[model samples]
Target chain A: MDRLLFGDNQFFGVNHMSEEKARAQSMKFQDLSAVIDVLDAAYDEGIHTFMCTTHDRVGEIVDYMRTKPERYAEQIFYPGMPYAHKYANAMTEDGMVGAIKRFLPDGGLLDAAFKGGMSVAKKDIEGITTLLIDAEMKMFQGLPTPVIFLQNVVVDLLLGLGFKDAFRIFAEHVRKKYNAEPGFISMNLPTLLKVLKEVGVENPVVCSNINKVGFRMSGGGVTAYEKALNEYEFQAIAMSVFASGAIPPREAIEWVCKLPNLKSIVFGASSRSNIHSTKVLVDEYWVG
Target chain B: MIRIGMVGLGKMGLSHYSMVNAHPDVEVVAVCDSSAYLLGLLNRYTGVETFNDMSKMLAQSNLDAVIISTPSVLHAQMVKTALEAGVNVFCEKPFSLNPSTSRDLTELARSKKLVTQVGYHYRFVGAFKEVKRLLDSGAIGKVSHILAEAYGPVVLKPKGSTWRSKKSEGGGSLYDYAAHPIDLVNWYLGVPSEVRGTILGQVFSRETDDEVFSTMVWPDETTAQLSVSWSDPSQRKMSTKITVFGSNGRITADRQECQTFLTDATAAPEGYVEGWNVRYTTDLTDEVYFYVRGEEYSAQLDAFVKRIESGEIEGQNSFGSATGADEVLAMMVADANRDYAGIAAGPAPQVDRGLFRRRTKS
Candidate 1:
């Protein structure tokens, strides 16, 4: 019997700078060789596939990955995106720091600084869109990258736009400019599938949570959130297997086993022990 | 307290570093490896001092013991060096590539009366501990037969002409991989009175077979089937498992994960032991007395320190802890060789996977 499809989900948020810096710093002692060694160990441990979110770093590795496709070909999965850029220089350091501080509880000066920092991050997302979009087009043509987008329930009240209003703009941009099919843009609600159904997402439809679902925390563990059984008619994804460390492997496997509607379950192992445990679950549940 | 030094800063060495350093009353202060790269890795990750030379590291560390986690071929030399330094030692599995070197290492440990331990972490897993406990308690009366299965993906990829790929360096799957379960079987049940197995290199392009299957017959007429493989595709990992068949009951242990469940048929409701309902109740985790038996790696180190302090290591086989591991590897290697030869000569090892299959119709 074929095992259930399993892949990891990794997307970059605005914390990209810090993450790159960390990797770059580590590369002083352990360069791409170090990363490759770890990746090889993972592959040897049976993690045959890795899903990299659309980001500049991912683009670099994907290019590296293409060169050694035999070693990495079956292993890397690319998810495309409509890049959102944020401008960092436009905001002063003190202004950014002040906003971050304001967002903090009790609104102290330090907390206001934290809020300011986050506002800059928000602004940065908007600024990166053009660069991200250009990279997305190049990636689609050159590689197996699948486009990914995001959908929220309501239109922008500030802009007085409906849901379709924003989507239509992006769709037109993709079609006229890139001349490529728009792939999956995850939606906040399954009901939004109605709008996407009209547009026809060529890529697979993935279902995640607007917030945490399931037990202890909302929409987290499978014990609490049953699969969206009523919405089973749509091709769906089961993401966030290890949303909380509290859900034991046995519980997760049992839940996934019961979900007949899911095309696949997405998860990953970050350590050797985790790989061992996940193998046990995969052998027991998916392989049977 | 046993003051110990460790060699090799690889994954296994790091594991030893953590285990030894974490032990109370033990000091793991000195580490060594020829690979400056690996030494830097261990130093950065473990914060232990490193030496490029094992001899210097041993002599200068002022330690009572050493753990050799270097390559397999280096195990014998390292163990001998530590023993000569009047240091008790703990060496990792595949004690040696061949029986002669293993025997020599064992003899040295015995003669020195040094506190030696072989790194066979599987023996400490709670699953087998429960199996031992249940059998001792007569929950599974008179263990008459046993079967062990081991397989993983490590064997399929060539160690690529490294020392691990050389027979002299213990490159074969049987030596490097099967040693764990083989040692476990030998520990749980005495050596097989008659051993035969089939080894297959059916996957990897190597001088040795990457997969193996064997059967052993105990003197008491009990039988065991041992299946070991390194050709699993998804991951180079394994689930070392065993099933003990006894007069009163049967137990299944997925030992690698430290999980086991058992059932006694003779003690069953209708004297029917073959079903799920007959499972004898016990917490497998609790049954493994590592926290009490003082058999944990740390506890083993503490014991060596005690021996050093008491001057009582004489006649004790310390570094020969791989005694069980070596024997298992030897047996698996022997069996695999015979199995492989037989296959190449047009006969295959006869196996019946269904023998253990439950009689569901009844």
Candidate 2:
């Protein structure tokens, strides 16, 4: 039976916590540890998936999994760079100039990485690769233990990266664009689906509500009853189920039940009241 | 007791039909529409007499007021006809295409001393009343910036004219969807000094613009930005949400349902409706009952009737006024005519890059 997954998506005291406290907490548990705690709580509460941000957390998450090799035996971190999810440390006031000097070397590290045959240590390559994998795996582990990377959006930004590095490129794209615009994290469903097919992943694309909200607010085609959302090729996490709140509870319930392959909804509410309203999915909707 | 007549048999019309039919101080004695099927539906739904022609229904029915739910363009003529025949009028919005027409209607109703109401229902929403209270009480201090968004696609008719595709019929996203926000912003800002807007045919390749965005400046030098569109592809009903920012706090309201917020730097308390009835009462005078005692429709209709009976034109005019709807349309039209470079040449702007961003480093 497909059940609705609901849980807090933000940290405790998100509203009440001071920015200093939040920053300190984020820094103290700067790596995968923070993500693990959240996922553990969410999983225990029946939340099967979660999203992760931060580079240090990536390494921390992978390191924790290393201690439990058996639990992560079958898992594979999709290979990619941390371009999209780059660490703030990489561009800090102190680090930016150094990075430009070290990587760019007058030309830039991005330019240098493409120029091959420069003698490189296996240790260095492995270390960089490990950090990259750790980041992706940390995000992965935030999902249910058996969670696999479901190529969610087509992320046009990920296009052209070779097959082996497609997933890594996808992550980089996310890191790069997540906040460049209001709905940057949202990828075109149809495009993402096509890329996922080419990448040969059978994992379902769980559509997010980030784009849907923006599109809906702009009076875009997001509301088309026949939009790509209703198409059979995709599965979705109705992120905006409580979108307008203008829709009667009964009507929203009926609408969700009619979807062809709707798996679950990723509620985006933050307030306690908003979180409570999430019960509309289980109570009023799937009660029958 | 005030006597009333009803027109149209759609959901809104039927709602009013029942509202008046069930009122103790009011009676829905006559009804009219162009559809016999609808007439039959109304007959089965209510005990009132129905007619195919409005004139016949108006001439024969012993009514002191008429509720119109016909298409927007027909509102003015029907309202004028009803008033000429000595009937008080309650009609729906898009308040006759432009401000001049709305003014003309208001003047005509005044001269005849007819009680008139134009349906801009959000005024009755609980959240809005609270927002008004906050603005009045200096809860948000001197309001400076306002942003309103109301965007959603048109629910297309199966085999009828898509009037929203034409400019002549007051058809377009600007006049259709923006009417609510225009009314809303104006209601909030009193009278804005200057209005500038952009209307475009973004998704719909039809004749009229499918999307429109506007920025209005109030007399107090406060500014408001509104975005409206009819290109939403989903079948979901969307609405206007207004966010007013001031020196001390911010207030946001879900325009249709009236869910609201007012917060200062320390902590923001959000209100929720609880208990058996789930009535959302505020820290204000207006109490919004989510589920009206099954008597709200009748209550509003009864109010309309009392306004006519009392000959209190000003009170009814203020409550059901369509004063700001057309000015928004006029601004939308003017903004649509502006060149992109022209707007860019004029001012320094604040741009919201959005909430999330990629981490560049550790």
Candidate 3:
């Protein structure tokens, strides 16, 4: 696993804690060129993995990167699937299948299956799930996507709804079709880890909020997270390491280093200085 | 374990469903929604139970409590029905479309001593809570004026209108979005006694106002400038902020952090200097056992469940306080609907509009 992963939240105006900062970022990154410049900056800083939600703008980033392979030879994209807003707009006009059909790489088979039999409708979930994954993966066709994630919104929802098998389905399908590791992004790590272990996905890769203060950590907060990280046999990728800029960088990084079994830290930086500084912080503090 | 039934499967409904379903002390026995697909999907996945109608779910589910996350139009009816069924209710914001109905529901809940709550989740937010604490603790003395503002990207262009754009349903930006900031103001400072110069301005939606601006006047002459806009693309999502100016110092807070300026060292709280002090939401917030979108979401649900178990009819976001917010909203509605000439808008005892203060020759 990459020790330093770049995230797209800053470009997408998704500061979890501060609206003012989010608005400022939205204004700063309205142009695609600004986004590309930052990505190039991160790449120069030796952070190659870009973990991003499959927002429409990401397609443009993928296309831009595809044009110059040599320039971004080592750069990798970790795509998170099922951007809800992308589906929402289309769902309002056409039904779910119609929305899926618009994005499905090979809609003909799914369309015929839906028309030919009612069986898929009854258990349309797995069928639709694979199709949506294909649809989202289409944008990253030739790119190296080593890991793919189910967004926390859907993963947490599925977790709450008690469909433990969905994790297995997501894992198996991703492994079989995309040749990538299936990762789950959730707010509740302990509960999700238990479910993944039950579903037989050993050493699963889980990304969540890992910080000193219990900002968004759920399922028994900081102490429970400490217990899980120490005991569980899983790769933990810490996001929101600074708790959305609430905690100072040195303090946040120092605290996160104390946790056991941490595989990586993903963060978003809008400037070259920020990227450089964060990389330095991680290197300086992660000696343990 | 508390046997709870969920109604509605919209965006908020789905979130509430997840939190409640995962809660250890609660069992989501049945769900109700108008969407066949959502209901079918939940039934297939969880196999709890599903209903297309609220009354049917209330009758058959044998629920200890029902969480109503439907549109504002349905809250009054569903809350009334749930109360009559002898189950606690957690209704979404803008408790009722009409102020009178808000009053009646509060009265009915009080009479039955049923645990009731409104979904003003902002009350559970840490930064906003700190704002309330600072005010209640007399850290900021004799607040004279306040500026409450909310902006969001709900309506960026003149496009299709959802239920939120329909004024008749009390689903306009005023009720759906602006009510959040207004609730914050009401929570910090009591509900204003007078609403003046209320302007329900429209920027995008033709069916309803996309922006709401009003001046809220308290009984003691403290005033707040309420400004809100849902047609702002600059904001990625809904951002509510408040700025208060008092005799001693000033205070400003949003969902993320609270900043305070103290003129004198005497007014400063512990670990705070007299100049400027900031408390981030991360430090201010407490951990929730089941975290979703935000801890506040789970915290509110936790509070509601605890109240129900403790048999406390009044707690955070009680129907009584919600009614206060609704009364202020009703005042804004009336002020916006009324056509005002300059003379008539003049404060009593009716000053003539033509009179002007003498000005020096420029």
In the order shown, the candidates' DockQ scores are 0.02, 0.01, 0.44
In model 3, how large is the Cα lDDT of residue A56? 86
| Tens digit per residue, CA lDDT, model 3, A1-288 | 889999999998787666677878988999999999999999999999999999989999999999999999999988997786666545332444566777777777666556543233534667867877887888899789989999897888778878777888789889999899999899999999998998899787899999887778888888899999989998899999898777899999989987888999999999999999999998998885
Please provide, for model 2 over A1-288, each residue's C-alpha lDDT reduced to its tens digit, 9 standing for 90 to 100: 134543222432121112233335445444455556544544444444343333344445556766776644433332222333132222221232232333332333323332322333333333343344344444444333322232322232232111223444333433443311011122234434454555544444444442222322211234432354555354455544544343554565566656555656554333334444555455565543
lDDT of 1 by residue, A8-124 (tens): 222221111122323344443234554455456567766664544444555565667677867765563535442322111111111222322322333343333234431323223
Where does the lowest 10-residue lDDT sum fall in candidate 2 chain A? A178-187
TM-score of each: 0.50, 0.49, 0.91
Q: Which regions of candidate 1 deviate over 4 angstroms?
A: A1-288, B40-47, B158-161, B200-202, B256-283, B286-321, B331-362
lDDT of 1 by residue, B1-362 (tens): 66778787554565456545545466778878765544543454335677988889877889887888877878888888888888877777777766678778778777877777666666655556666656656666778878787776554454343444566666666766677777777777766666765454556746766766777777777777777776775331355777888766677775422222335444333333344422111122221101111123444444555666777753222444456556656665666556354355876556555967754543
- Score chain A of model 1 by TM-score against the reference chain A: 0.57
| lDDT of every model, 2 decimals | 0.52, 0.52, 0.85
Among the numbered candidates, top TM-score falls to: 3
Model 3, C-alpha of A49: deviation from truth (Å): 1.1
Chain A superposition TM-score per model: 0.57, 0.49, 0.92
Sort the predicted structures by lDDT, highest score first: 3, 1, 2
lDDT (C-alpha) at residue B10 in model 1 = 51
iRMS, candidate 1, in Å: value is 23.4
Candidate 1 lDDT score at position A131: 37
Error of 3 at B229 (Å): 1.5
Over 4 Å off, model 2: A1-288, B44-47, B153-166, B255-302, B316-320, B339-362
